[model samples]
Target: MKTLLIVDDEPRTRQGVKKTLEAWSAGRLRIETAASGVEALEWMEENPTHLIITDVRMPELGGLQMLERMSQAPTKPVVIVISGHAEFEYAHKALQLGVVEYLLKPLDKTKLIHSVEKALELEEDRLRIGRMEKLLDPKLLEAGQVEAKYGQHVRDAIAYIEGHLQDPIGMKQVADHLHMNASYFSVLFKEQTGMTFSDYLTRKRLQRAKELLAQTRMPIWEVAEKIGYQTAKYFIKVFKDSESVSPTQYRQQVSDPEETIK
Candidate 1:
């Protein structure tokens, strides 16, 4: 089932649209309503919906501004703009913002149904295409081929980890990314990499840290943050433990070839 949000300042219009869509959906759609664009945005911060039916004009955060803010979201909902005939010019701008459908005021049931179906269909297509792209990501399939110890699934998981090394990524996140059970992913990861997930992540982060220390002049704390460590002290401790030297010492050694030779 898909969730839809209706945004209108008028209570009658909001509830009317929600009720109509609910009746037509036959449990296929979960309908929600907001009296204004501000309320709609507040609801969206907690619950993301598949589609939004928004009036073009409202006081205190109009529909266009709300759509602008939503553009920065990691996943954006399909939008259908509702406008009075006088607001036809504003509807054109909504189209520029990628509103999927432009609906006129005093909506017809048949047109509303058609637009809703089309928007949902498009949403499904977008999701399917996204999954397919992730599955067929060339870099994901290509990494770790030199050892061939891990299967494609493990390789894909590794790719996700590497790509998101800056984030506070965890084993569960990688497992979810690969669509596997956390425990099962842990076992498979150990079998394929010959190390626990934590160890592998630590090793990778250290490796990245070493590269950055040698290749760039970024501060130690910044490097730690970039490589997913929350604090430089912890990163330095781990680095010393794993390499028998602190990050500073390693950087000095790698940066000065003559000192290393001596």
Candidate 2:
């Protein structure tokens, strides 16, 4: 079971959220509430919370301030901000801080439950990926035995590809960087990663583009530019082919206020 920490100043709001989530979750969740940001921070320090749903306006430390404080912790908790109509700026700032979700006041039960579900899904995905990367690290280190002569070059090339996935990445550029022929480098990369370099790069770009579309109100063209697509039309074609939906529709589906985060 995942633990959730709810932070809000109002007694009725806290009770309402707790009741709603408890009913919606059907007893699958464990929830704790704090009356203010200060209390929330204290609770976090003493307990482990996978997700936090906080009100943006509080008496002492506000939701954003609590988030900033959490940034310094060893394991930062994911946050979702609850804001009223007057605090739109604070909500936007929370989004910029990579908040998992933002809810308006007079919270809809379905939307709140969906946001919680989505946050948990994202958190689980992150943990699973972390575990996979850890397991891969040992195998990557062992690869040094077979490719001892070219190990460093291979590592550098992989690093470069990861760092520059949003840019135009070509076999020629990687080959030139490693002082090898394009054909030779292509074969080497495929042998190492079990996937073609072009395929790997495309997957990385699409992953990033999906994140941007899901989390922001950025236009489709802007998302394409951010993910290294020089033409929006081409980007749309590729995204649709890969995802079975156009970028706009993908965003709409994933960004639904009432949808779960999975």
The lDDT of each candidate is 0.81, 0.78
Candidate 2 residue runs with Cα over 4 Å from true position: 86-88, 138-262
TM-score of 2: 0.54
**Model 1: number of clashes?**
0
Once fitted onto the true fold, the runs of candidate 1 whose alpha carbons sit more than 4 angstroms away are 86-88, 140-262
As for candidate 2, its clashing pairs are 118-261
Q: Write the per-residue lDDT of candidate 1 for residues 1-262, one digit (tens) a residue.
A: 5789999998878877888888899998889899888899889888758899999889998898999988877678889988776566687789888999888889887899899999989887776555334223232234345446668888887788789888999999899988899999999988887778887787778767877887789999999999999999998999899778888887776665233212
Residues forming the 10-long window of minimal summed lDDT in candidate 2: 131-140
Best by TM-score: 2
lDDT of 2 at 81: 87
Evaluate residue 222 in candidate 2 and report its C-alpha lDDT on the 0 to 100 scale.
Answer: 87
Q: Which candidate is the best by lDDT?
A: 1
